[model samples]
Target: MVQRHGDEQSHVMEREPLLSGTAQPDSDYHACHSISEEDTGNGVLKPVPEEDEEQSIGRGETESVKDNAHVNVLKIISVMLLGIFVAQCDGSILMATHAIIASEFNALKDSSWLIISFSLAGAATQTLYGKLSDIYGRKRMVIIAYTMFMVGCAIVGVGQTMWQVVLGRIVSGAGASGMSALVSVLITDLLPLREVAQWRAYVNLVATLGRSIGGPLGGWLADVIGWRWSFLGQVPPITLAIILCSAYLPSHTSTVDEQDAAATDLLKKSKFSRIDFKGAFLFAALVLAVLLPIELGGVSIPWSHPLIFTLLGASAILFALFVAVEKRQAEPILPLDIFHSKDAILSFFILGFQTAAQLGMMFSVPLYFQVTSNPRPSATVAGAHLVPAVVGNAIGGIISGSVIKRSGRYKSLVIWAVTCSSIGYLLLMLRWHGNTNWFESLYIFPGGFGMGVASSALFISLQMVIDPAHMAPAVSFMYLMQTVWMTIGLPAANAIMQTVLRRKLGVRLLELGYDSAEVAKIISDAVSDVDFIDGATEKVRNAVVKSYIDGLWWSHAFSFSCSIIALVLAVFLKQRRLDGHKSKP
Candidate 1:
């Protein structure tokens, strides 16, 4: 019995009806026949959200209900922007100020763990959180996640040493991971199909804004006061988010879409049903075993060392178990169906590599600066650099958001974004060679802008492809891959750069003119050389800079490749109008 909804009457099939708890059978979005609230459309049981009115041809005798839907979408966009900014800002700030952290902990020798632990924890839990978000409500899950992040930030702020900071970051990472998934899910929950990009643009811009602003802010705060304050800075945005969320985010249950609203829909009301927790465990274990070694390996011993191999072997076992269990389990954390979408799997792979390369650049650039300096910026001074990345990110966010708001589709923006990123990396490569100027960094802003566009486009893309039932899992899965890539890529970049520097710069040092045998003497003497001569040691300084520049070229190369791959992926995606009714243009 579908009770008619609202005061107005419209077309018979297109008539608005609230959920009245009737078991009226329909053949719609799902494979199984069941009664579900459906969109105004053909008699097929579509996914959870059946809001597509275009397909529902007869729905609007007058479009007042349709008008009301638009107003609600705008409200949802505003709420999502708040969450995106809070979470993005947190991730952006960490990279901006890692240099400051290393000095404080006195652990420059073994610093990857500081980065890895937080990343690993975040990656490990994201899938679980994604599933839980679907099981629980996205709004409630997000709020709880943010609170946990804030708690972690607070803990990091008060910590005395590396472990404390690492602990805080891990907690923060877990919370942040939860948001990464839910933010996308929320976009689907809130927007009409056509307006997904329009809605995402706002959140994407806010995220870019937070990152662009936060880098410098984190650096400035750490430079002026202390490194601990970088973590401390996170509290403001998170606290602001909590307050805004409480005020603006309306209550929403994690409603199951018609497609896989519950296992019963797909599997005839299974008497025995629970997600294969064991498989999820194995997956997390697999991620941990492989990732932990990759991140911590080169630091402890060579990459080919027995210890690293041992862990990798164990990881192989865990992954095998995860795959076997998932394939057999009635309900898998990873829906095998999703992988069947070649485009989705390929996109996930590309996106993961892109994340790794991006984060690796963020992780390495500061270290290049610090290692060369006899003494790096007092913790506070160096941290200030984070401000520029933050500002650029914010501006990029705004540009992408504003543009998408006007345009229904993000295809051109995706192409442009990737192109710009490619240019940024190429320019960054040049800057590393000898052109360390702010104008070179203009490339970075565009790169970030491209990232902003890509993030919006990618999030919407995943949403468009999957059944509404799988939306949360798909999002979380994307997140997990990204985290894994970042963990692997950052340290791997570090190892490669270090190895390259030893070969390129170490042997070449002072051989150009300054005495090779007397290099240290020359450096020491140069402190007083200004008194003895024309202060020609500027050449030495340039040489040192050149070394960093050369190493950073690898980052630029990787970024360029990632952007190229993204462009290639674009070719496979059929264009669609954001009008959201389905079937691509």
Candidate 2:
């Protein structure tokens, strides 16, 4: 089947078919063009006999047929962009409406799982899809992902119980994870190396646009029609996107040139032997064991509980086993060779830590505004404050891409990103208090801009350094790092906010002549139901607002610390010029 694709390439090969008015395939691109059966006495090339003309015409017809069967590259990209846009939109759509969902289901205590389940499930399946895409095909995997997303959305739309919504989100997230990795791989397959930077910028822009739409739209949907419509409304567009993608997306095969036939033959024999099931299991186990415990520790159980320690110990053991399994596998899911260089290792950590910081801010900023806004906006409109930051992110990505295209360097942009992010976080940290609108609004732009620059620059830099054939797995690993760090960062910040909010709320409630248990219930209601403060007396409402503001200040401080650490790490990055040629020039 793979070799048949090579033959297909030959049959359809054309020199400037796209440039020339003709859609005909040139027979000269085939082997017969270079090695003719007969040669003219003159030093000029001669056309083949009319007998061979029939065969050449058949090849031309075959080319046209193949063209009709597969969509053009541009159409494929457009459809893929839509798919990614939908996936990203789904990720943040529920952010502003979680309180509503909790209130309706009477499951406020368990509401955190609505977000965590989605993220965790998505992260878990990313690497799995990357490997499977390599083994099977990219288009097939993407279609599968879309189908899952649609089904998950349907489940959430109809769900009556909080646990049902959590399950639906987990399913939705599992499917959405593939869109990011697969879209990235598709970009590399379709575009030239130098051009990829600009295209990536477009993708980043689309992602930001999705987030921008999601936050405000979610708030609006929750306030007017219902929170469930937020999930249901996405169904029609996503379904349309799925149909377009299925019809238009081109098939991706692993590129194996004829010159490497002998190696290809050897690889074919060992391909089945190289699945590395043990390594896959160990990797999944390690991630789940570590993240689940952290997620549940401060939220569901105490941090010092025996279960947390046990899970941590088990995670450490699983890590060692995963390493051992990789060493023994014929073709490891994660190649150890990629980490042999210090720069590659540093790139992973840089993205991990950087993502953790930004994601922390993404969650915390919205919550800060929800509690402190003067005469608070409707539940659906509360996330409008996030719009400016998202716009700044788009601007930063565009600039980063343009600069890299001109100078062919990423180090300076990386440093700019880190500095901007750190400064933004620091400013926000200082400005955050009881006010929703203030200096904090100004700082969000820089913070978002920094994140945009850093993310694009780091990925481009890593691709430049790594081997091309290994790019898919490397990209998958980048996504994994993002998911893991995000899982850790958000939960830790929430823990801090929750603990402090509980303590401060207790004191305020006690001063107002409430008992300890009554104070606990009120604090719970404050976090669980956005409508709580509206019904409370002015004195209690003021105290509740102040407590939330004070608690979130510490969360912002933690995010600031993360940015500072990322900025310090940026100083150590090794700068390199990207080589644009297919093979090193």
Q: Which portions of model 2 miss their true places by more than 4 Å?
A: 1-73, 96-108, 158-165, 215-236, 252-262, 270-274, 433-440, 500-549, 581-585
Stretches of model 1 off by over 4 angstroms after superposition: 1-71, 74-84, 92-112, 157-165, 213-273, 360-412, 430-432, 435-438, 510-542, 576-579, 583-585
User: Number of clashes in every candidate structure?
Assistant: 33, 2
Candidate 2 lDDT, tens digit per residue, 12-106? 22221111111111112211121121111111122233235567668786455334322344455678788777778776778777878988888
lDDT of 2 at 137: 54
lDDT of each: 0.60, 0.71
Q: How accurate is candidate 2 locally (lDDT)?
A: 0.71
RMSD of 1: 7.5
* Per-residue lDDT of candidate 1, residues 155-203 (tens digit): 9899888888888888887888887567666566544544555555556
Question: What does the lDDT read for residue 363 in candidate 1?
Answer: 61
**Index of the highest-TM-score prediction:** 2
Worst 10 residues of 2 by lDDT: 17-26
